[model samples]
Target: MPFIDLKTQYKALQPKIQRRINQVLEHGQYIMGPEVKELEEKLAAYTGAKYCITVASGTEALLISLMALGIKTGDEIITTPFTFVATAEVIVLLGAIPVFVDVEPDTGNIDAKLIEAAITPRTKAIMPVSLYGQPADMDEINAIAARHGNIPVIEDAAQSFGAEYKGKKSCNLSTIGCTSFFPSKPLGCYGDGGAIFTNDDAIALACKEIRVHGQSQRYVHTRIGVGGRMDTLQCAIVLAKLDRFDHEVEQRLLIGQRYNKILGEAGVTTIVQRSDRTSIFGQYTVRVQDRTNLQKYLNECGVPTAVHYPVPLDEQPAYRDLCKAGHTPASKKIAGEVMSLPMSPDLTIDDQDKICAALLAGIKQ
Candidate 1:
């Protein structure tokens, strides 16, 4: 079975996707076509955000959001060390420091309690990544940000476009929410794409300018920026896929619930989803002993498995000296034990059963 089953999704929406592509080809406005604005509007309405700005990629979205917030060199951005490198890479790219924080062992999300302690006078923002399709505690994070001079909060919602937390969508829960459409994400396009969402009008306008070489208008360079415009064709592809996005989210929830129920009964430690939150099951991850051995056994049994992260960002060679010494125990332990099973909206129950059986056998070995 395929890991994400993107082919199946494509087959399901072939007609719509073909039609959208045909329209884009006829228009021939590849850079920023009418479909780009159309998709942005739909995403803003769906995410309950006043403005949405599409960009070249998720990294660009994060960088643009930081720029819009006026985060400067030597500023500190508090975030978890247990997420994808992009979470911290953006800070370093802008010559800002990423103050590492530990994550919860159960949810693999940033520990909100540890955030405030990491804040210093130089702290300009708090970036929390919504790992494995589950949102971080935005309410708590936002409260901390508010208490500390209203520091900007950027939610890295790359893995959690369809996720919900405390009655709000993941991308709409913070000061600036950034999500990716990197083909494998919950809501993805045909190529690299991302979006930044916010209710603040000024920040939204700044992001629009920052996305296009900091131009307020043609040939009017307003601020330092990058070429970060999302292609119109990619935007069109996302628009086509939007038709079945709600249905895909429901299927992902059902598959995740089923996996949790079966794996729990079989003595597997599934990722915990809080009562006030919903996961999109981007990875269907679990913590298991002897992860390397289990992975080999599953491979032998025709079941594919992978690791979301093999090392904490603090432990990575590039940023080891920058992180706090002797912290991130949970992140380290989870890195060694966590494994992700095959998961997708089209994943069949029979396939899941086979995967579970293989996992149980691997543990026995």
Candidate 2:
């Protein structure tokens, strides 16, 4: 079985995809085309955010958001260490210190209760990642940020574009939200693309300016920026994918629930999704003992498996000295045991059953 099953999804949407691509080709305005604005508008409305700024990639989305907030040298941005390095990388790129915090053992999300203690006078932002397509305790995290001089909370929703937190969309739940379109994400484009979302008008304007070489007008340099605009072709592709994104979200939920039930019945340890939130299950992950042997067994049985992260950011060679230390025992522990199975909206039930059975049987050995 394919790890992500993007081929199946593409096959289903071939016609619409071709049409969208054709439109982009005919327009020939590849940089900032009409499709870019159309997709941005649609996505902003979908997330219920007042503004959306499409960027070159998810990493750029985070980097540009920080630039908009004026993060600088010596600024401390508190975040969990248990996510993809991009979360902390963007913070450190600006000469800012990434204050690593522990995550919840069950959900593998940052522990909001532990955030306030990590804050200091230099703390500029609180960036919490929505890991494995499920949103973290955004409401609690936002409340914590509000108490501490109203620090800007950035939700790294790279894995959770279609997710929800207490009726609010993932990208619309915090002071600013960023999501990726790296083909494997819940809602992705053919290539690299991403977006920044915020309700704050000034922040939105700053992001807009910062994404295009800080141009307030044509050839008018207002601030330092990067080459971060999302290609019009990518935007067109995402717009086409948006047509069936709702159905895809529903299917992912059903598949994820089924995986939970089957694995739970067999005594497997899976991550928890809080009742108040909904996940898109970007990667259906589970914790297992002796993960190496189990992964070998599953692969032998035609099942593919991958680890979301084998090492926490703080433990990484590049980030160890750059990030501030904290008591993050949970991040280290979870990194060793967690493994992601094949997950896509198009994943078949038969495939899921076989994968789970193989995992269960592998555990016995």
Candidate 3:
């Protein structure tokens, strides 16, 4: 089975997508066109955020948010090490230090309890990644940030655009929320795109300026910035995809539940979602013993599987010195054990059954 069934999704939305693309082509305002603003408005309304600024990519969203928050060189940003490199890469790109924190073994998200201890006088922000389409504990993380001089909290929600935590959406839960529109993400565009959401007016204005080479107006360079505008074509594509986003979210939830049920019957450990949270099932991963052997057996049985991450960021050569010795043991352990199965809104139950059967047989062997 295809890992992410974008082909099926496209077929279902082909008419709408084609219509939107035709409109964009007729308008011919490729950069920051009408569709760009249309998408921002729709996303802001969907997430209940006061503002949404579309950008070039998820990486740019994080960088722009940090710049808006005034995260400077030598600033310390507390974050977990159990995520994709982009999580830490953005911080380092700004010459800021990423204070490595361990994650909970069950959820594979940053442990909120350890956040306060990592805070120093130089700590400017707390960035928590919503890994595998499940949001981190924003309530607890926000509380910690509030106690410590109201440090800004940025939720790296690249994997969790449609996820919910308590009564709030993932991208509306923190001071700044950033999400990716990589083609494989839960809510994705045709190509590279991302957005930053915020309720604070000042920060929102700052992000708008930062996205366009620090220009408050045309030829009025207000501050240093980058050309991080999301293309109109991508915005049109996302708008087309948005037609069935809610339905897609429901399908993802149903598929996730089915995976949990089937995997549970086979005595496999699936990723756990908390009672107050709802995951979008971006990966539908599980922890298995002898993961390499399990993957090999499944592959032989015509079941495809992949790893979300194979090494903790701290263990990566680029950031080895950033992590304290013997830190982030849980992240390292999970890296070796976690395996992702095929997941998508269009994934069929029959395919799921075949995948589960292969997994069970592989384990038995």
Candidate 4:
């Protein structure tokens, strides 16, 4: 089975997708066209945020957020190590130090208890990645940020577009939230796309300008920025996808809970979900010993699997010298054990059962 059943999703939405594409093609305003603003407005309304700024990709979203906040050389940004490298890459790209904290053993989210101690006078921002489609302890993280001089908290929500935390959407739960449309994500487009969400008008305005080479108006360069505008075509595709996004999110929630219940009953170690929040299951992952052997067995059983992350950022060769790795044992250990199962809104119950059976058999073997 396909790890992410995008083909089936495409089949379901083919007509809408075709119509949207045709509109874009006919308009011929491929760059920053009408579809771009339409998507930004729809996303803003969906997330309950005052503004949504679409960008070329998730990585660009993060970079632009940092730039808007004026995060510069020697400024420290606290984050979790157990995530995609793009989380830390943005920090380092702007010449900032990425101070990593360990993650919770159960949810694989950054440990908020350790975050406060990491903050200091030089701390410019706090970035918490919403791993596996569940939001990090954003309320607690925001609280900590508030206690310590109201540090800007950027939620790296690349995998959590439709997730919710404490009745709030993932992308609207922080100072600035960024999410991706990287084909395999919960809400994806045909190609690269991302957006930033924020209630802060000043930051929102700065991001809007920074997204297109810091131009306040056409040809008026107000500050340093990058050409990070998401193409109108991709926006059109996302708008098409958005037609059924809420329903898809519901499907993903049910499917993820099904995995948790089934795997837990079989005595498998599943990722824990908190009561106050909802996950979109961008990847329905679990922790297991002997992961390499288990992956091999599942592959042989025709079950495709993946690892969300295999190495903590601090332990990586490129970043080892930047931060001490002594205190991030949870991230280190989880890296060796976490393995993702096939997940998507269109994933069938029969396929889920087969995947679980294969996993149980592999674990017992």
Candidate 4, position 33, lDDT: 99
lDDT of each: 0.92, 0.95, 0.93, 0.94
Error of 3 at 317 (Å): 0.5
Quote the positional error of residue 358 for candidate 2 in Å: 0.8
List the candidate 3 regions with Cα displacement exceeding 4 Å: 322-326
Model 2 CA deviation exceeding 4 Å by range = none
Clashes of each: 0, 0, 0, 0
lDDT of 3 by residue, 1-365 (tens): 78899999999999999999999999899999999999999999999999999999999999999989888888999998899899889888888988899999998999998888888899999999999999999999999999999999999999999999998898999999999999999999988999999999999999999999999999999988999999999999999999999999999999999999989887898889999999998889999998889998898888889898999998899998864433788998999899999999999989999999999888888
On residues 1-365, what C-alpha lDDT tens digit does candidate 4 reach at each position? 99999999999999999999999999899999999999999999999999999999999999999999999999999999999999999999999999999999999999999998888799999999999999999999999999999999999999999999999999999999999999999999988999999999999999999999999999999989999999999999999999989999999999999998999998988889999999989999999999999999999999999998999999899999876344999999999999999999999999999999999999888
lDDT order of candidates, top first? 2, 4, 3, 1
Which ten-residue region of model 3 has the weakest summed lDDT? 320-329
lDDT of 4: 0.94
- Regions of model 1 farther than 4 Å from truth: 324-326
Stretches of candidate 4 exceeding 4 Å from the true structure: 324-326
Instruction: Write the residue-wise lDDT of candidate 1 on 251-342 in tens digits.
Output: 99999999999889988898899999999987899999988888988988888898989999998999887654537899998888889999
